[model samples]
Target: MAGKQALNIVKIKKMKQDANPITVITAYDYPSAKLAEEAGIDMILVGDSLGNVVLGYDSTVPVTLDDMVYHSRAVARGAEHTFIVTDLPFMTYHGSLDETFRNVRRLMQEGHAHAVKMEGGAEIAPTVHSIVQAGVPVLGHIGLTPQSVNQIGGYRIQGKDEKDARRLIEDAKALERAGVFAIVLELVTEEVSAAISAEISIPTIGIGAGRGCDGQVLVFHDVLKYTSDYREKRFVKTYANIGEQIRNGISEYVNEVKTRAFPAEVHVFAAEEGVIDQLYGKGKAESES
Candidate 1:
């Protein structure tokens, strides 16, 4: 399989015009990052989704900048070849441009992310611009943003009606104007998703948005069946049912352990008499203990 392409805002900018689809996936830990990189994932988002998936939180709103830093650093270590984008958790980008820049720097300088992603439109244009000016690339997220879950209500499709669609299109434009590398469209109608993709100068990476998007992103847990929350969304096409497979495999192991079928010689190591004697007079006391 093709490995991850060299990832940066410049390549993504080119992809916007070239219409090449980018692939993004969230990875919170080392093993996931290593496998995602090896599987040729184009980008690894150290998204605040980890607050829910890894930490068992109900929403990402509670994830702090420190939390993002810790997870981003871990993902960065395991994904040397993949471009890693760390999310600016909920309140990290608020109040002042200076504050935003400081948080972005911390995530980049300490967390080692190539870029940062934030959710907003015109309201956040200034912050996005300031971050880019400060030398950190920004990725925009629009339409059904999770960070605004409380304000916007629950998770649902966005940009369906005419007003909402227009707003989404405008949001994409605004993000492009703010000099974002790409914009993520979440839970949007296919028509609106397509329209935004066509209107934007930056690549549109979709989640619940449809096939016309320039790229697609999914939480790692949702993709790999580690998500134990709700069932799959309409847009999610499961590539594997690893959950059931893992469950069955573990169940078999449990049954085997109960029946004493696990330690069937191949699973344990044995030593010859003379070699054992050399190591211990009869056997090591540590072993006996």
Candidate 2:
């Protein structure tokens, strides 16, 4: 009810061409997706960050294709009008082309996602190409891919130097050629992100990559401060303190219950006058009254 219309590949590409900044948020469940839709977010990503935020995992490397599909289905049901992109979790796309296609098919058919996002650079372009050719839209990701965090030696900013910057640029261009409608640049240096945005025709959705991108994305929980123990990140701008509010509200409920202040007269149902007397002994009820 909040958004204008669902965005498609053509419209998304047009936004980049028109220099319109697209907005995206990660929503892993029904209520989160509903909130994102009601807020009129342009796109909803069923990100594998759910491993950390939703599933209590240490990193996204532990997330699987099934986890993505389950969450994507919930998000799709809630945000029916918004474009939904589901992540191909670790190892789902690293196999043979046929295996990758099967994974992509499950995300599209069972997950009900409009598109599937894969991490890596030019190295994975051919796989992206094959998915696109199979009639599935692909979103590319680069710069600190979480699925390969261990390989990359942890979540470090990428493209700080000349050679790394060039590689990112090449990755972006190759993704474009491979037919990805957009690419996500995560934790890349601002200069390199801007350069990639300028160099490529497709929109670049930035997380920590800076303002030069055609669009931006952040996790729903991160934006709303929904995770009580989540450490503050440099790139995140929390707009609300819902976690504290929840804690306070629940604490109040507990105090009220302990004090017998809740379930007062207004919260109870009255029995007929004689019914109570009959339930207890009549003489006892009369004497008590």
Candidate 3:
């Protein structure tokens, strides 16, 4: 496949204007990022959802800026040609502006990310504006922010009611005005998501927010079935059951080993005729002498 064209805010905005649906995937490691790039993904997000899918955490709350930097570095190395965005993680951007700038700098300079994605609405708009002013691109996320799961009362659909829908629209507008290149609408009702997309000039990337979005993103593990125990999300449409395939392959290998079927003649290396015997005999002779 051809190499991915490097993306920037101009190109991303053009994609939205042209009605070309952008493709995004969350990749936590080198291999997944490389594969996603090869598969022609438009963007790679090093989401804090790695806390759940890769690190075995129940939620994204515990993910730290260091964790994000480590994973984002891996993804950046793997997909140099693709646009990469790294999450700021829980509380990383909620504190002082200095702290937020430090986190964004780490993600960009150390982690090698092209931009940073922050989860919140108008409340975080000023922070986003400040970061953007400092020459750091920001991707805003609203609707069911995972970092606020406890406060939001679990992973439920957001903006289902009229009041919430209006709020979501305003959030999108606020984010756009704050200089966010794009926004991610997660778990909002389809109608509300569509309204937000229409209300904002920047692209809206949806995860569980239906097809009304200008772009769609899903976790790498979710799309490829990386773990058998991963409770399938309604929004995720698994493209491959690699977990099952891996399990079956491993089982076959185990069975072959137990039955002495593996390491067959073709798999084994043979020395010259009588070479082993000569070595042993020579060693014995030397010892005896």
Clashes of each: 0, 0, 0
Clashing residue pairs in candidate 1 are none
- What is each predicted model's overall lDDT from 0 to 1? 0.87, 0.93, 0.92
TM-score of 1: 0.90
Candidate achieving higher lDDT, 2 or 3? 2
Per-residue accuracy of model 3 over 1-289 as CA lDDT, tens digit each: 2745789988998899999999999999999999999998999999999999899899999998899999999998899899999999999988999988988999999999999999999999999999999999899999999999999889899998999998899889999999999999999999999888887789999999998999999999889898968686889899999999999999999999999999799998878876855878646645676
Misplaced by over 4 Å in model 2 are 271-289
Distance (Å) between predicted and true CA of 84, model 2? 0.3
| Cα error, candidate 1, residue 254 (Å) | 2.0
Cα lDDT over the full model 3? 0.92
Q: Which regions of candidate 1 are displaced past 4 Å?
A: 1-5, 228-230, 272-289
Per-residue lDDT of candidate 1, residues 149-263 (tens digit): 9999898789879999989888889888888988898999999999988876778899989988999999887887864344767788777777788878899999999999997
lDDT of 2 by residue, 16-85 (tens): 9998999999999999999889888999999999999999999998998899999999999999999999
Task: Give the root-mean-square deviation of each candidate in angstroms.
Answer: 3.1, 1.8, 2.7
